[model samples]
Target: MKSLTLPAVLATALFALISPAIAQYADGQDATPEQAQAYQDAQGCILVLKAAGGDDNLQMAEQAMAKAKELAPINGDDTDEKFAKSMKDWEEILGLASVDESKQFLANCRETWSA
Candidate 1:
């Protein structure tokens, strides 16, 4: 029998939570400026999470996310519709890779950002 994996499980849960806003983009609808910024910032956080390989990774990720929030400040509670939708969009774009792939991307992000 095939076993369920963590990423698969997470993806399934994400699909259930996210809105059809993902599909809206496929029809050539452009993201608003706020949406674009949120996606960009989330993508950066995803990289930081991947790069944080030491014991404090989760803390690092949380700090980075909080800082991003302070800087950009999206609306609504995380469980609320609007915020959840934005998270869904951000994850749809930035959450595709496996762990190894994310690590590779993290390395690249570090190089690009540090230069």
Candidate 2:
């Protein structure tokens, strides 16, 4: 997998600290930090898979992304800002990820997040 950029990693850390109270699963359970990170990774993986462009990968990536979001949806008033930041982070990840790395991310997402 590609290493996370410093800014993206920092933004994620900051968001976790600032919005701990607002972040929760669809079932109303508080999300652990690891769960939140997995969710973010799944989102990033989806972007990578989409850019790579294969029907099979896209289908699995979408399923993983959906499951990740269902388990840990971003909530509260700053939802738009949070999503914007996440998109930027995913873009950065996409830029650095090689085909093999991107495929690894997709695999990880399917294993960790897909239903």
Candidate 3:
């Protein structure tokens, strides 16, 4: 019960942050190529993480997240407006579906990619 609560809480918070970004896309606004690619990767990772109950699925999610992170631009101080916005969107996805092994995978991705 406690374990389930954590993921639920995290997912709720993630959704809170994600709604606005999603609305932009929903309004038929176009995302840049980089943003589109990153969104696709993160969306794939999140779906796999949410449904995954095995190591194989977890691995696939991790790989997808890694690719998403790679496509996102890193900004020290997050001063680059577009890059910062893109990362915020990507991080929201990480928050939404990451749990247990998926959380560990996100941590690893951050560590490896941090500037």
Q: Evaluate residue 70 in candidate 3 and report its C-alpha lDDT on the 0 to 100 scale.
A: 54
2 against 3, candidate with superior TM-score: 2
- Per-residue lDDT tens digits of candidate 2, residues 20-110? 5335544586665456655665566667667656777688778756744564444321365766576665676556656666556556554
Off by over 4 Å in 3: 1-35, 74-115
* Tens-place lDDT digits, model 1, residues 71-97: 333322234465545555556645666
Best by TM-score: 2
Of 1 and 2, which scores higher on lDDT?
2
Residue-pair clash count for candidate 2: 0
RMSD for each of the candidates:
9.7, 6.6, 10.7
Off by over 4 Å in 2: 1-29, 72-81, 98-100, 106-115
The top-ranked prediction according to lDDT is 2
lDDT of 3 at 71: 40
Q: List the residue pairs that clash in candidate 1.
A: none
On the 0 to 100 scale, the lDDT of residue 17 in model 3 is 41
**lDDT values of the candidates?**
0.45, 0.55, 0.47
Ranking by TM-score: 2, 1, 3
